[model samples]
Target: MSEVMGQQKNNLELNDNFEDHDSVSDSQVVDYLFAHPDFFVKHAHLFEELDIPHAHKGSVSLVELQSEQLRKKVRLLNYKLNQLISIARQNEQIYRVYADLNLRLLATQSMEEMQLVLEEVMQERLQLESVVIKPFIGAYAFPEIQRRLFVEKRFRRDKFFFGRLSEHERKLLFPQQEANSVALLLLGELGELGMLAVSSKDPSHFNPDMDTLLITQLQQFLSILLPKLMKY
Candidate 1:
């Protein structure tokens, strides 16, 4: 009976202390925990009982929540690393293709030879559906729509355009074949000399979202090379 009375007294004292400190802030508790690192070691069972609110799921143990966050971070890092590797591989492949095309262009002695080499590279190497290199001298002879496209200088700002082409545009560039998308590169001083058009059968093959580094490099190469070819 005496022991029971003593336990009841201790409980009453603890309750009174809690009531006195009813407005204890979270920061104060955190600071106390940080100061006494062995607090959890003395009450190790708290690891099993402590519940933390999760972002996606219901309340979980603190350890489980921390582990889940680490796993998510690792997964995100792996996905970003994979994307970087894919981009590097794609860049390497594009470099090889450009190198081969440059070597072929160097071997050409005449304008016809240069055109044939370009067509071969576009068809066989790049797997394009159609390729056309047209001079600006006869731009007025094309249909009214095409003549307007050239006369209006639509590509004067960027020197290039890429995406799905209209029916008339497709017909004007790829008359012998069908194309779902196209990349039009204005050659030689903003369409002053001509234009180079490359078409693909896939609708999304040449969208605006794609990186145009390869096409831009090719345009610069052609701009320098075409004038020399025409002179010969």
Candidate 2:
């Protein structure tokens, strides 16, 4: 009975915590700021602070309540608005990086040329990051050269890395990160076909939240392009 009571108490506490968070979220101060982006620059700080919990001291007089509430409203709204602005800036930068990459990828006429050009683009476009062209492993080869690369056992075997690695033979061809780094495939070809890895001293630089479509499309561009380019 005691154990059961403890579990019940724990559940109650969790439910209460959830309710408090929901109440704060429903305050909608941050939402209003986001909807009107123009107000953000002046009131961003308030929202940022309000994102976390704030307590009213018990000794505070009721007269101060109005000002206190206003401060909280502004603080939380400011933080959230700043976050949105930051996201917009980051997305703009990522788009530019891919745009620069596409320009170079389309210019290559052969697999070797593409590799050189892609790596050069990744380096210049993404702060000297290293890139690799990984063909699919453990699957049927469309043509002859890929079969040879497979037979030669030239592949990096890591499922943590993604993109086009034909459902079979996959390997790491180029790398610049440390022995232990969490990498996000920000953009690439398919079957690990065309992949990019950015390295930084900060271990969290490559955490999983990054968007990978840009790199994925790049991989797609290379998958067919590499095979056709080899002929030239």
Indicate which candidate wins on TM-score: 1
Q: Find the number of clashing residue pairs for candidate 1.
A: 0
* Candidate 2 TM-score, true structure as reference: 0.49
Question: Residue 163 of model 1: what lDDT?
Answer: 83
Tens digit of per-residue lDDT, candidate 2, span 1-232: 9999999999999999888875676448688757877874676565444433337554443335557878999999999999999999988998887887777778876666866876676656665445554433323223456434443432344323422232233223323243233232312233433223333334445445556677556655655565565432
Give the per-residue lDDT digits (tens) of candidate 1, residues 1-232: 9999999999999999889796888899999999999998899899999999877788999889879889999999999999999999988997899888987787788767978988888888888888878766542323556655854654756888888767776777788886898888877875566788888998999988888887888888888887787762
Report, for every candidate in turn, its global Cα lDDT versus the true structure: 0.81, 0.54
Model 1 lDDT at residue 18: 85
Highest lDDT model number: 1
Clashes of each: 0, 35
